[model samples]
Target chain A: MFELLGIPPQALFGQVLLGLINGSFYAVLSLGLAVIFGLLNIINFAHGALYMMGAFVSWMLLTYLGIPFWFALVISPLVVGALGMVIERTMLRPLHELDHLYSLLLTFGLTLVITGVFQNFYGVSGKPYPIPAALTGVMNLGFMFLPIYRGFIIVMAVIVCFATWFLIEKTRLGSYLRAATENPEMVSAFGINVPLLVTLTYGFGVALSAFAGVLAAPVYSVNPVMGNDLIIVVFAVIVIGGMGSIMGAIIGGFSLGLVEGLTKVFYPEASTTIIFIIMALVLLFKPSGIFGREV
Target chain B: MTHTIEKSQADTPGPETQAMLEVQGLNGWYGESHVLHDVNLTVNKGEVVTLLGRNGAGKTTTLKAIMGLLKSRSGSIRFNGTELIDLPARDIARLGIGYVPDDRGIFGSLSVLENLLLPPKVADGGFDLPAIYELFPNLEERLDSYGNKLSGGEQQMLSIARILRTGALFVLMDEPTEGLAPVIIHQIGHTVRRLKKAGFTILLVEQNFHFARELADRHYIVQEGKVVDQFRNDEIADNLEKIQGYLGI
Candidate 1:
């Protein structure tokens, strides 16, 4: 109904909501990347593939097995995480003592294999997952109309982000994660099984990506190459935020998403490139990242 | 699991009857280089023994080998009747060994309380928080502080305190007083004496003979990668010149 600087309130609100939605994906995906990088120092190039797997797995469950979105949400991640754990133990764990480049290559190859298989079976055209029956309507909040599912996404991202904070900062298991990340040998000497922790941490990190993937399934087209494009943006978020702190990743993701959204409103052509430009600026000035001091 | 460690302890001899630790013909390598050649030594229950050596003389490596910290190590490291050479550092720790390293490997990210809580309880009879704080009052005062925030002396104390909480009767300390004020060294010495009185076996590596002289019942002098000589605390009085001349200090 109102206009500011010749931009209608509807356009601004609509894009702002879109920005928040994209930010939620960034937050969830980058949280997993930051955690994996912090402890394992592995780049996990297959992160995007795993995310695609999460969405596709959920899609498979809904289509083939007649499972609902809620059940698929929990089941998809567990199945994907279990697969991730096996990959860690069999493939990544042996290369733990080697250089980071080895794991990077290993994961990159893994990404290609996953992408190729999915593309072979499904092709490039995408499948659209239907929004659940309960979350189909929109709520009119005076000047702005909010889609309930979209609002649900924003709330879910906030919840997931804060839950990670609790898991990493507050609990005793978190203490071990923090300690082991610093000097795993010392922690091992202190009588803790660090190898097992690494395996679990890898599984958990990928599980977050899968969870984000399931959240994304209903929003985005469930295609093989869907994660291929989004992962680059998610990684940019991690680079800008610095895989150092959980909160840093969350804020970085949300803020960058909003920036991209705003760019879409002001200049449609620059929306995609804006995040990369900021990422370059961040890397040039603060190479350690905004949350650089922490691990 | 804790069961692996507990089961080994149960098979050992009763307390005070035999040697708490018996390391024989131990050898260790760091990558391509051999560091420890023949580090044979023993520490009976409740006894205090010191590994005396100059820098780079393999004293620290001996301790590392015993604890299974080295990836390539050989020969026997028996702790309370369990052959420990095959076990990993963590398993050896679970078999009732506490290690305080030279660098005081404190996790900077964790708070003081978390550092203390990091090591799982290995056995019964470990000092409770009140008892540990009584021994090192500074730790209690700085419980909320980060591990990296502590002073050199406090970090050293924290390192020692955390291990003591593990109820590990066989204690291995590598230069606990390496860089500390005189007062702090005296306090550590007093703690060692008290630990001996409480029936904990100590295998300490020291270049500070004065500190070693006061606390050790026996001293094993390391040269290069072998135990070249040994002296009982009583017998060291007569061999002071030879010991000092050998030490070159």
Candidate 2:
């Protein structure tokens, strides 16, 4: 294998591949956030907590119930999504008439409660979730040994993102969601139940976060603190992508993940702060975000 | 078309009759500040009733209250003999009351066609897309354009068209011609005339007295959140002074 600029090709390509995988998660999570924010007008601060819950739920299913990873994968998101619906109906619905900040605060409080409860029960230690037996293999390319699971993750994320984009951009239900986001009263006047739609939209978005959480559970430890740090990164991604667009969320997430990964390769110390720095730059130059439209 | 004539003939009543839409002692508050107080009015089927007032005269608030957008304090709103005071905005809408806010409630991010498609078919009566296109020809041309990208007149037309897609029998339109060019205002006036001809009941709120006078068969002037005066179409000319005094026009 030839070395470029004294760096081995394998190492460079491997980091790039890893960056792309991380980007996949970012894209999926931020896409969910954008969808939720577009309709709910609420920055779901509890998104990370919900993500953690998704992972924990899967872990619980496997450990206590003796459920297989395959079943847990499908069932955990639904469980978390149901929980999201209940939260939306009970808590978020009451704050609909209030300021946008109130919804944000309420979601933040919810995140704290969820995270605290999970931590109190599970402790701060990370729990290992075994990779499904079928996915426990590596495919060696000419340059690098690629984990089959990571590749599966990237493909699944892409499919999910595209499916969501189609649902929102091309479908009638999506039309109603977009319309409701713009003028809820007007949509309600059309005999479409706007409140029910709001709750469902919130649940869908939370389910997306949970989906990402379940996908990450095998890669990362199922920890109570799993969502906290990832969410901060996602916020930066959203700021860069702009909340006004669904595609922007996807692109912003992946691009920033790749950028962060590259930063780790070239300058490891800057990796942590690079996303925030990019966010500040985007805000300074384009406050609406790279893809965001002005309200 | 035959039914329209029958409905009009049936609508003729003596001095007192049951109203199609009735608001009595209606009061509304935004937070703590009372915006509408003791507002009373009635709309008969096949009527073009205009609510005339100056800025901040609670004209728009009355429409919102009817649509259940505001918190009703002490009032009775009966739309087609159903109490609307405690109902949600969606329920009021399902009752065949279409509300067009003063802002022209267009979904800016959505295309004009998408905006039209946003409102679900109300009461299992299918929406006639061609009928709406016939009403607003400009909307037909700019079907792919985003609501925000439309001209003020186009946005207004789309707003009205959006509501019409719901097949609502009663429409409460707030300032459809506000800030529009004269040509667009003429178009809206024409649309209102067409709507009235089609046997649609309308409660229009407008600041332009001239426009209101042209479209309205009956008028209710509001001052300080109360109905101050009422006039028949024939009495409007005679009551211009009173209208000017109240509206400052």
Candidate 3:
């Protein structure tokens, strides 16, 4: 048993592992926010609520419908993404020409509605989602002990983040999405159905959030208000990373998570406030964000 | 100044050649600002026309209105005998009409090759990569450069080249030579002549009198959002002073 700075190695490793887990969530969630903001220019306030829906939907599938976790993983995101598309076409489409505030307000109201419905049915108490049988063990790596489920989460988050980056930076569809984000009229002039593109982008953006939610289901409590709290942290990560930068979102998430984890080790009281403090300092110096190009 | 435009009467379509594009009583606005008013014009098949005007004379607005880019536009815009007044910009583009704006809307973040390949092929005759490269060798040289990184002339060329790849029968080019060195301007003029020879109908908007005179078969003098005057290529020689006077150049 090794000790560094008066903290035992196991305790330090435990906190670091927890930080990685939280970082994974931030990376995936912030990636969604970035994608949505890039294309729609709307800060999706309902993202947290939608993420909660993903977890709850997966929970319900297993509890009432006898659906396994594997099947629920695929089913939950699809359901949430379909709902996201409906939201875009019906609520967000008409607000496109107006100020961005309207969309934000609308999504905020939607967040309340969705969270309220879930709370009404399920209440506030967190429900446990049993970890799958295959990932129900711990790995001891000399200096640290890692839960297989947490390692799975970290790996999944990294894969999802990189896959999203590759999709946007290396593909033709991504080129159109990026081009449309810059100038929708010009992209439309190129004969692309930009309205349809916008609709799909919104759906895809929220789908990423939902996918993150599915991933979080096993780790965090499947509670209605779970996303409401996590989303704020993700927003901080976005501000620090730069809005709409794929690479920035991914890196910002993990780095902030680790910083928070390290803070927990040094001063337990400041663990939560450190992200906001860093966000403020980053805003003061690099307002465009770490990866953001000039707006 | 160096040459009077070769009047390509042989290339100009006859009066019986049905109009390729016709705009009747077209009106457009930017919010409350009325930009184009009662603009009526026609582009006959295989003819290169110019919309000659000073800045903010509604030349660009007319082109935008025809392309359905302006949301508050009304009246008639008929392309290839099909009514196009209410079509979305995307639908209008899909109908085989291409636009090259004065600002040259190249995606700054995208590479030159991406910008060139961005526009989808609209018809069978659209320029392929080899043809586009052959037409503008400069584009081939800067294939990997970002759109914003290109020189002004290169951006303009890329802008024009992008539309040419769309196989659009009618191209509405707005001030293609707004700011360019003489050599690049000369090259654009040469390209315009070659396109006209290749049977592409063009409705060009230009503030440059010398450049427009060299490429346009007919000229429409726009004054404050209205079509104030029109003259044939032969009439251009006699009306050079009038054209200059109208443009206030």
> True interface contacts reproduced by each model, as a fraction?
0.76, 0.82, 0.63
- Give per-residue CA lDDT, model 2, range A1-295, as digits (tens): 8886777788777778788888998998899899999998889999999999988988999899989788877898899999999999999889988999998999999999999998899998999999999998999897899999998888888999999999998889999998888877777766779888988999999999999989999999999999999999998899899984798998898888889888877888998999999999999999989999875
Candidate 1, residue B178: lDDT: 90
Give the per-residue lDDT of model 1 (tens digit) for A182-277: 999899998899999999999998998999989988989999988888889988898889865677789999999999999999998999999999
Model 3 score (lDDT): 0.89
Candidate 1 overall Cα lDDT vs. reference?
0.90
Instruction: Give candidate 3 regions above 4 Å deviation.
Output: B1-16
TM-score for chain A, candidates 1 onward in order: 0.97, 0.97, 0.98
Model 2 clash pairs? none
For model 1, state the Cα shift of residue A77 in Å: 0.7
TM-score of each: 0.96, 0.92, 0.96
TM-score, prediction 2: 0.92
Name the regions of candidate 2 deviating beyond 4 angstroms. Answer: A95-106, B1-18, B124-127
DockQ of each: 0.76, 0.62, 0.71
- Ranked candidates, highest DockQ first: 1, 3, 2
DockQ of 3: 0.71
Docking class for model 2 is medium
Residue-wise C-alpha lDDT for candidate 2, range B102-151, written one tens digit per residue: 88888888888898887765653333777677678788999998888988
Q: Which stretches of candidate 1 lie over 4 Å from their true place?
A: B1-16
